[model samples]
Target chain A: MRCIIRLTLLEMLKKKILYLTLALTAIFLIFYGIAMNYGYDSLRDAEPLMRIAVSGQFLSMGIYALGFIVSFLSIFASVGSISSEIEQGNYDAILSKPISRYEVVVGRYIGILLVLIPYATFFYLSIIGLNLYFGDGVVANIVTVNILKSLSVLYLLPTLLTSVGLLLSTYLSTMGAGVTLVILYFCGMVGGILEQIGHFITGEAKVVLTSIGITTSLVIPSDIVYRKASSILYTTSSGMNFSADNMLGASIQPSGLMLFYIGFYIIIMVVLSIRKFQIRDL
Target chain B: MMLETYNLTKQFNGKGGFKDVSLSVREGEVFSFLGKNGAGKSTFIRTLLGILYPTSGMGLMLGKPIGDVETRKKIGYLPELFQYHTWLTGYELLYNHGLLYKMKKNEIKARIDEVLKIVGLEGHEHKKIKQYSKGMKQRIGLGSAILSDPLLLFLDEPTSALDPLGRKQVRDIIFKLKNEGKTIFLNTHLLSEVELVSDRVAILDKGEMKKIGTMKELLHSPLMLSVGNCSEKIINELKKIDPLLERVGNDIKMSVERDNDLPKIADSVVKNDGLLYMMKRKENVLEELFINTVGEEDVR
Candidate 1:
């Protein structure tokens, strides 16, 4: 397993995928940096609420953009963890060694996470830096401890999505896993939005959206956790009287229980992928 | 025994796997599986390596049940057309392989140089595998396989992508390994390789073992006699000396227990009004035995 991790990291570096990802992230940050500056400049003459509101909008967009980039990286990185190696007939030589199959799967997961975690942290911190600069030092009003909480919760979203991609990889082909993950991503996003706003819609529309949300949540709850993380970032005791569950300033926050559930989800994905990969013939 | 299997069967939904194979390979011999593509050679090796579960029966390698990690420590396998991590340099790949075998860092580093030398890859260690040609990739693959200096080696078509000289060089290495008291299980349809190095060979066809024996035992030395027969008298006379003598057109083929019988058969044919055009010993090559054993099907 150590060998696998070491070799995988070496491969990523040699292929320049790590550097490429970071470079792509830098470009994204540059664009975000420019947009944040312009958005803040426009809000200079606006009312304080409207300024905070636009700044908040920029902050949310920054978070979502970072989230999307991380999600894309995680999915593409993990979707081929086992299936591609098996397809190319490379696993036979490696798996024939004294190492257990579980080690390979878990080690691969660690290798990918090792690359992604630093990527996530760098990008997440960059966005926070932007938030501090463009939001007129608005986030400074929030406690540093609360900022840490929000950062951690925000980072966990990518980790959860990565686990989902890995879980799908153990059974599906690379393309199949990627497609399924996209579907699941949209499901979580739509389900989070519709279910949170189901109260305004009357008649059967409410019933249909609620059913979709319930089913998607039961199956894959990563998007809901992401929304919960957004709420954690902006919502406070002195915040607006927002009834919107999907909003960052919403009153309905995800409980601590869901954090543990995401933890459980990671463990279950790792275990299931290992179990399926153990008996898989290459 | 270095490896043994008793009625081992590994069928994928009752197709495309070996069946009821019972064979024992002693230590320090170059044992080979001679078969064409889709002939179950790779399947059998995969099963023995614990890559695939046997549908029935059992196997043991180095006195432990198949797939035993401890037992695998003494075994090295070079799979067919092995596709390595192309982004890795040859040195890094060998180093990683040594780590997989749980070798100490210093020991792995020390052995990597020697392995690279043995595989004739001394100067190319820093080159990425993507830059390697087919033969270079194959040699690097072999280098990793033997990095731990295993007691038993399994090579599937080890020389498939190699040139003629590369094939000979690798073959010499196999011989050297055998001289070092290492047991090797080689799988290939290359009859010449089997003829030169294999102490024992197993012929597999359509997921079944057709024959298994030592090189000499498999290749029956037959005397070929081409003649123009004047009567059935020569045929009856030849049958008296060997009941299994076969008549192929104007030629007769019969296994000779001794060279003295050849003279007697020629005298009988000449005295019995038979015109003996030629009298010579056949090549008794592995190709003949392979053809005879598997028959001429899609052994390709």
Candidate 2:
């Protein structure tokens, strides 16, 4: 199992995409830093409350982009982890060894997480670092100790993606798994928007839209995790749910029950992946 | 017995896989499975190795039931379509396989050197598999299969893609491993290979076992004689030995059940004034057996 984990990590490190992603990440951080510096300077004369609102909104956008990149990376990296190996006949030699099928699925999951966790940490801190380094007095004030709590929630985004991605990988072809996961991810994102819109409106439309959002979250809780993270960050700092005014913000904080459900969702996905792989013919 | 299967069956939707096949391979013996494409030869191997679950029946490898994790520790397999992670170097691939077999790191390190030399890839160990040729990739795969010095090795079409030289190299390796008292279950459609290396051979046609026996029991080498001055007396005398003796242009072809009949055949031909120009047993008797067992139309 350790060998499998090592091999998976080595394969990811050796991939050209990892380097491309890092290069692109460096470019993104640079642009983000420059934007924060210039945007802070432009708001120098703004009133105090206006500065806090604008900086919080700007920081929310940066975190949203960060989560978006990590979510896609997690999905694409793992969607083919099992299915492609099967398609290419790579598992024949490996699986015939003394290791159990459960180890293969779990080892790969750990291997992917081993790479993704540190990466998410670095990217998360970099965005916060840029926000702090280029952040004027207003930006610093809004990023409170609650940022730590929010970062933990942000980590769930990739965890949720990888678990579901691996589950789909066990059942579907690489293309089929990838397409389905991406479509589900899009559904989650659009559902979040509908929920946010539903929060602002009233009557039957509100109930219907919010129900759709909650339903998609039940299918895949990725977007809800992101919203929950955002809510933790902005609401704790500003003493207000800024998403009500800011479009990118979390309008309704995902409940504690949703967090428990996400944990349950991940376990089921991992368990199902192992069970499916064990019973299926490679 | 190193490997045994009793009525082991694996089919996809009740089709295209072996059915009710039972065989046992003894220690230090080379067992060959002969079949055409999609004959369930590979499927049977995979089932025994626990890569594919058997739909019915049972199998044992090294006395443990198939799919038993500990049983796999003593087994090695080179898949018919061998594809390793191309990103790994040859040494890395072997080391990882050894790790999967639960070999100590130091032991795996020591074995990698010997395995590389055995597979004729010593200098190429550090080269990535993607950089290696098809033959080199094959050698690396063979190297991985033999890395743990397994008690039983399963080689499926082990030499299908090699050049003549590469094939001979693999055959030599098989000989070396056999000499060390290792059990080898070889799956191949190559009749010549089966004839050379197998102690016992089984022919599978259309997912059914058509023939199974020792090499001598399966192949009947016929005698082809070039006779000079053949006359009715000589022909009539030879008919006693081979009633179906065929004569075409001074050449006679007939099946001899035993080598003891050779001398009597020579004396009968000579005494009857039929000069014996040449007398030798026919070649490729396995090909004839295979074709007869499985119809020639399905030959691959």
Candidate 3:
């Protein structure tokens, strides 16, 4: 199993996609820092309350982009983890060893997370650092506890995405897995936006939109993760609870029960991936 | 027995995989599976190796039921059309494989040197697989399969990517491994290679086992003779020796069960005053057996 984990890490590190992702990440951080600086300078003369709110908005946008990039990277990195190896006949030699199929699935999941988690952590911290450093006096006084809690929640983004991506890889071709996971991610993103919009309106449509959001979260709790992370960061850091008017923040704080469910969701995905790959004929 | 299967079956949606394959490979024997493309040759190997679960029936490898993780430690496989990890140097691939086989770190290091030497890729081990040619990639794959010095090795078309020299090298390696008491299960459509190394052979066609026997039992050199006489007496004399002798044009082809039958045949034809143009045993006995067993149709 450790061999499998090592192999998976070696594969991920050697792939060109990792270098490209790092290069793009460096550039994204630079641009985000510059954007925050310009926005803070432009809003300097504005009312204090307004300046803080807008600064929070800038922070929310940066976090949103961070989550987006991390989630996609996790998906791209993992969707082909098993399926491509199977297709290319690479698994034949590895699996024929004394290792169990579950080890391959779990090892790869952990391996990908090993790289992605650190990457997501660095990327998450870089965004927060840029927002705090460039926002001057406008950024909120984010305590260490809030930062740690938000980082933990942010870590779930890749863990959850990697789980789902691996599950798909076990049962589908690489392209098929990639396409399905990407579409499901879009579904989660759209569902979150719809639920946010639902909070602002009143009628039968509002209930329908909220129900759709709840259902998509059940399918993939990706959107809920981001929302929960932001809810923790903003509500704790600025004593400003999420409202529908904050376009970039969570419209409604997800319940504590949802976090437990996401944990269960990731476990179930990992378990199912192992089961499917075990019975499968390679 | 190193490997045995009883009524084993694996099919895709109830078709296209070998069925009811019951065979046992003894220790220190080279058993070759002869089949055309899509003949379920690779499928059988995969099933026995536990890469694919059997739809029905059972198998034992190294005395454990198939799919047994512990049992796999003693087994090795080189899959047909295998695409190895091309990003790693050949040395790394073998080291990783040895680790998967649960070898100690020092054990792996020592085995890599021996494996590289056997596969004839000694100095090339430091180069990434992607930099190697197809034949070199195959050699590296063979190196990894034998890295653990497994008790049983399954090589599917092990020489498919090799040139004549490389193929000869593979054959030499197989011979060397066999000399050390390792059982080998080879899958190939190359009849000549099978004839050279196999103790026994099984022919599979369209997911069905058509014929199986010791190489000597399945193959027979039939004698062919060109007789210039058109007399019934000459035909009758030859018929006395081989009752089922076949006449094609002015030639008589008869299966020879023993080499001593050749002189008897010539004497019979000469005594009858038949002008004998030629008398020679036909070559490529395995090829003839294969064509006769599987028929003359192309593999789909």
| The best candidate in terms of TM-score | 2
lDDT of each: 0.83, 0.89, 0.89
Sorted by TM-score, highest first, which candidate order results? 2, 3, 1
Model 2: how far residue B241 lies from native, Å = 7.8
Write the candidate numbers in order of decreasing DockQ: 2, 3, 1
Residue-level lDDT tens digits of model 1 in A238-258: 763222333432334657887
lDDT of 3 by residue, B123-193 (tens): 99899889999999899889888988899999999999999999999999999999999999999999989
Better of 1 and 3 by DockQ: 3
Clashing residue pairs in candidate 2 are none
Selected candidate, larger TM-score, 1 vs 3: 3
- Each candidate's DockQ score against the native complex? 0.57, 0.76, 0.64
> What is candidate 2's TM-score against the reference?
0.94
Please report how far candidate 1 places residue B226 from its true position, in Å: 11
DockQ value for model 3: 0.64
Q: Candidate 2 lDDT, tens digit per residue, B30-131? A: 999999889889999988888888999998888889989988888889998889889888888999899999999999999999998899998988988899
Q: Provide the lDDT at B57 for model 3.
A: 94
Clashing pairs in 1: none
Q: TM-score for each prediction?
A: 0.89, 0.94, 0.90
Question: Runs in model 3 with CA error above 4 Å?
Answer: A237-244, B222-281, B298-300
Point out where model 2 deviates above 4 Å.
Answer: A140-144, A235-244, B229-275
Ten-residue stretch with the least lDDT total in model 1 chain B: B291-300
